[model samples]
Target chain A: MSFINYSSREINCKIVYYGPGLCGKTTNLQYVYRKTNPDQKGKLISLATETERTLFFDFLPLALGDIKGFKVRFHLYTVPGQVFYAASRKLILKGVDGVVFVADSQIERMEANMESLDDLKINLAEQGYDLDKLPYTVQFNKRDLPNVAPVENMNKLLNPRNIPCFEAVAVTGPGVFETLKNVAKQVLVELKKHY
Target chain B: MSGSDLVMYEEEFGKIDEELQRLYIQTNAKVVFLVDKNGQLIASAGETHDIDTTSLASLTAGNIAATGGIARLLGEKEFTILFHEGEKDNIHISLIGQRIILVVIFDSRSSLGLVRLRVKKVSEALTRIFNDIAAKSEREKSEGKIDESPFAEISDEDIDNLFR
Candidate 1:
C-alpha cells in the first residue's frame, strides 16, 4: 500500500524482500545499505535472534527520485528466512506493495528454493494475494558459486511465469537494486492500473 | 487534482507554517503532525523539531496499526483515540473524523481537556484535505503509470554497480 501526502507532494510504498533461508535476502539489503548515500537512507534496523537468525525483520527506508512532482519513497523490509519463523513472515507481508523472491542458485539448494517459493505462494494466498498475479519478481542469487544452478534452469523451474528474473550474486551486490527497481516499478504500474 | 490545488507548491508556506508554529507553542507538544491513515503528512508543528519527520510520519502510522489490533480485541468496529503515558512525556493519538491522525506529544502541564478540544477542530480540517489526497492518489494509481518509471528499466549490471 502507498500513501500520498498532498501537503508535501510525496508518495510512499512498502516493498518486501522475501525468500528461504540462506537465499541472500538479508545480504541484498546489507549491500544496498552499504552502497546507498547516507543522506538518502534511514537507519538499517535488524531484529535478529541470539543465534543470529532474523528474529522479526529488517527495515530500510530509502528515497528514490521524485515521480512527476511527487517524491517517491520506498520502505524496504525483509522477513526472517528460516522456515520456523513463518509467523513473523506473515506479519511482515502485511500491506506489502511488491515482493522480491530471492532464490538461492547453488545447485544443492534447489529444493530449498522451490519449497520457499511454494511457501511464499501459500502465505500470499492466505493474505488474498497470488504470486502469479501480484507484482513480483525473482532473483537467482549466489550466481558466483560454481555449484549454482544455471540461470536458465532456475528460471524454468522457479519463475515459469516469466515475471522478470535476474541473475545475481547478492553477496557481491549483483542485481540487488535491479531486482528492487523491477519490483518497485511493477508495483507502481499495478497501482497506476487501478488508478 | 491539478497542481493548482497543491497547498505545498501554491499556498504560502509561511501562513500554514506560522499556524503550526503557534499551535506548537500553545500546546507545548513535542511532536505534532497531521497525516492521513494512509501515512501521508499534511502539516507538522512542534518544538524539539530536530526529529526525523519522515520516519516519524510512518512510525505514527505504525502506532495506529498496532492500535487497530487493540481495537479488534475490544470488539469494536474501530478505535478513535489512543493515549500512551510514558515516563517523561505522554502521547495522545486521536483519529480526526476518521480520516487523519491528530497526534500530540506533551508533558503534564497541558490538561487532557485542552488537547481533546484542540484536536477536535484540527481533525475536522485535516479530514477534508486527506480525503482529497486519497481520492487523487486513487485516480493516479488507477491510471497505471507507476510501472513506467525509468528505474524499472534497470538491469542486473546496474544494480551491481550500485553497491560500489
Candidate 2:
C-alpha cells in the first residue's frame, strides 16, 4: 500500500523483490543501495541468518524525485526465498504496492523459479490481492551464468502475461535500475488512480 | 494489509497529529507514532529529533506482523498488544481496529501502566476518526470527486532523472 501524506507532501510506496533462494533478490537491493546517494537513501537493514541467508527480509528506504511537487519515497524490500521461510515471505508481501519477480535464469534452477512464482501467487491471494491485477514485472537474473536459460524460454515460462521483463546480472548492477524504474513507475501510476 | 493505497488528506492528518500530541503529553511518553500494518509511517510526535522514525516504523510493523503470524499458528485470532523492554526505553504497541498500530516509547520516568491506560482511551478516539475518514473517502469516490489526473504532470523522464 502506498501512503500519500498530503500534509508532509510525501508519497511512500512499498516494492518487494521476490524469487527463489539465490536468485539475486538481495543483490538487487545492494546494488541500488550502493548507487543511491546518501541524501536520497536511508539505512539498509538486512535480517539474516548467521551464514548470511536472509532470515526474514531486507529493507531499504529510498527517495525518488518529486512527482508533481510531492516527494516520492519507495521502501524496497526482499523476501526470504527459501521454502521454509514461507511465513516470513507472506509477511513481506503484505501491503506490497508492486513486485519484481526475479526469476533465477540458471538452467537447473527453473523449477525453483516456478515454485517461487506459484508461492507468490498463493501468498498474494491469501491477502486478497490478485497477481493478475497487481503492478508486476519479471526479471530474469543470473544472465551471466553460462548454463542460464535462454530469454525466450524464461519468458515463455514466467511472463505469459508479458509484463515488462528485463535480463539482469544484478551483482554487476546491469538491468537493476531499469527493473526498479519500471516497477516504481507502475506504482506511481497506480497511485494516480486513487489520487 | 489491504491492496488499496492509503491516502491521508489534510483534514485527517490534522486530527491525527493533534491526538498524537495529546497522547504524548498525557502519558509522559518520550515518543508516540501511528503506523499502518504495512509499516508506513502515518503520524508521529515527541522526542523524534534523534530517531529514525521511518526505519522504526518499518521494523515495528515487521515485528507486529511476525507476532500476528505466530498468533495465527496458535489458533488465536489476534494478539492485540506487544511490549519491548530496554535499559533506557520501552515500547508498547497495540492494534487500533486491527488495521493501524499505535506505538508508545517511554523512558524510566513513565510507567507502562500509564502508557497503556492512556492508549486504551486514545485508541477509541483514533478508531472513530479513521472510520470517519474511510467513510468520507468512500463517499467522495462514489461522487466522482476522486481525480486521477494529479499525476498527469509527472513524465517518465522525470522519473529517470532520479537515478541519474
Candidate 3:
C-alpha cells in the first residue's frame, strides 16, 4: 500500500525483502544504505537476536527519485529468515506493495529456500495478495560461493514463472541495485494505474 | 484547521524528547523510541543509530498492532503495555493515545517499573503531538495544491541513479 502525499507530491510504497535465513537480505539492504546518497535514504534498522541473527526484521526507507509529479519513496524491509519467526514475517508483509525474494544459492539450503518460498506464498495469500499478480522479483544471492547451486538449475527450480531473477553477490554489492531498480520500476508501474 | 483539530500546544514535543533522553539514560537502556501506532517515528533517544531504529520502530509498532488486534478481539478498548524478556535483552512496548506506541529496549539491568513510569508521562505528551500531526495531515490534504510533479519527466538516467 502506498500513501500518496499530494501535498508533497510524493508516493510512498512499501517493498519487503522475503527470503530464507542469511540469504543476504540484510546485506543487500546494507549495500543499498552504503551506496545511497545521504539525503535520499533513512537510517537502517536491524533487530537481531542475541547471536546477531535477524530476530524480527531490518527496515530502510529509500527515496527512489520522482516519477511524473510524485516523489517515489520505497520502504524496504527484510523479514527474519529463520523458520520459527513466521509470525513476525507475516506482520512485516502487511501492506507490502512489492517483494524481492532473496534465495540462498546453495544446494544445501535448497529445501530451506523452498520452504520459505512456500511460506511466503501462504502468508501473501492470507493477506489477499497473489504472488503471480503482485509486483515481485527474485534474487539468487551468494553467487560467488563455490558450492552455490548453478544459476540455470536454481532458475529452473525457483523462477519457473520467469519473474526477473538476478544473480547477486550481495556482500560485494553486485546485482543489488539491479534487483532493487527492477522491483521499483514494476511497483511504480503498478501504482500508475491507480493514480 | 479547527480549534480542536489544531492543537497550538503541540510544540511541546521537543521538550518531551529531551525528557525521554533523560529517562533513557537513567534507566540505562540502550535505545528508546516513540512512534505512532501507525508506525511513524515521532522522536528517539539513546543509540538511535548503533542499533536498527528504523526496524525497531516498525517492529515496535507491529507488536502493538498485533496485540491491539488481540485486545479488540477480547473486547478491550486498548492495550496498555507488553513486555518481552529475551535471552540477553528485553523490549517494553506500551500503547499511547490508541494512536501512538512507546518502546524502550534495555539489557538485563533495567526494571519494568522504571520504563513504565517514564512511558506513562511520555505518552501523555506524545499523544498531543500525534493528534496535532494527524490534524496537520488532514488539513494539508484538504488545502494544499495537488498536482503531478515535473520529475515525472525525469530522464531514464536519473531514475537509474535512484536505485544506486
Candidate 4:
C-alpha cells in the first residue's frame, strides 16, 4: 500500500527483503545502506538478538530521486529469517508494496528456500494480498559461494512465475542494486495502473 | 487497516496539521507527529529539527505491530495505547481510528495525565477528519476523479535517472 501525499508532493512505498535464516537478507540491506549516498538514505536500524541475528526486522529508508515532482521514498525492510520469527515476518509485511525474495543459492539450502517462499505466499494471502498480484521479484543470493545451485534450476523450482529473477552476491554487492531497481520500477508501474 | 492505498490531499492535510500543532502546544510536547500504520509520516509539529522522524516512525510502527501480536496471543483485540518512559523523556503512542498512530514526545515538564487528556481530545478530532478524508478519497476514486498520478507518463529513462 503506497501512500501518496499530494500536499507534500511525495510518494512512499514499502519493500520487504525476505528469505530463510542466514540467506543474507540483512546483508542485502547493509550493502544498500553502505553504498547509498548520505543524503539519499536514513539510518539503517537493526533490531537483532545478542548474536546479531535479526530479531524483529531491519529498516532502511531510501529516497530515490523525484519522479516528476513527487519525492519517491522507499522503506526497505528485512524480516527475521529464523523460522520461529514467523509472527514478526507477518507483521513486517503489512502495507508492503513490493518484495524481494533473497534466496540462498547454495545447493543444500534448497528446502529452506522453498519453505520460505511457501510461507511468503500464505502470509500474503492472510493479509488479503495475492503474491501473484503484487509487484515482486526474486534474487538468488550468495552466488560467490562455490556450492551454489544452478540459476536455471533455482528459477525452475522457485520462480515459476518468471518475474525478474537476478543472480546476486549480496554481501559484496553484485546484482543488489539491479534487484532493487527492477522491483521499484515494477512498483511504480503498478502505482500508475492503480490511478 | 484498509487494503487500499492512502491518498492525502491538501485540504485534509491542512486540517491534520492544525490538530497536531494544537496538540503539540497543549501538551508541551517536544514533538508530535502522525504516522499511518504503514509507518509513513503524515504530518508533524513542534521541535522536530533535531530528530530523525523517519526512523522514529518506522520503529514506532514496528513496536505497535509487535505489541498487537502479543495482544492477540492473550486473546485481546488489540493494545491500542502504549507508553514508554526514559530517564528524561517519555513517549505516548495511541492508535487513532485504528488506521493512524498518534505519537507524542515530551519531557518532565508535562505529566502523563495531562498528555493523555489532551491526546483524547485531539484523537477524536483526528478520527473525524480521517474518516471524512477516507470517504472523500473513496468517492473520488470511484468517480474517476483521482486519476492525476504523474507516473502515468513516466518512461524507462525517467526511472533509470534516479539511480544516476
Among all candidates shown, the one with the greatest TM-score: 4
Off by over 4 Å in 4: B1-3
Q: List each candidate's DockQ score.
A: 0.14, 0.63, 0.14, 0.69
Per-model CA lDDT versus the true structure: 0.71, 0.90, 0.76, 0.93
**Interface RMSD (one decimal) of model 3:** 8.6
Q: Candidates' TM-scores?
A: 0.73, 0.96, 0.66, 0.98
Return the TM-score for chain B, candidate 3. Answer: 0.70
**Residue A54 lDDT (model 3):** 88
In model 3, which regions exceed 4 Å deviation?
B1-60, B66-158
lDDT-best of 2 and 4: 4
User: Model 3 in CAPRI terms: which quality?
Assistant: incorrect
lDDT string for model 2 (A13-54, tens) is 899999999899999999999999899999899999998999
lDDT tens digits, residue span A1-195, model 1: 565444566767778898889788888989989988997798777778877677767778887665656667788888889999776676676667788999998888889888888988888887677777778889988888888777888888898878788888888887987888788777766655443
Cα lDDT tens digits for candidate 3, B1-164: 01111111224455657767887987789788876553545567887767756556676777776776667679997678899988888888887776567788998778878877777876776777667666765664466421242423456665676665
Expressed as tens digits, the lDDT of each residue in B1-164 for candidate 4 is 23488999999999999999999999999999999998899999999999999999999999899998999999998999999999999999999888999999999889899999999999999999999988988888789874665767888888889888
- Taken in order, the candidates have interface RMSDs of 7.9, 2.3, 8.6, 2.2
Best lDDT among the predictions, by candidate number: 4
The TM-score obtained for chain B by all candidates, in the order given, is 0.64, 0.93, 0.70, 0.95
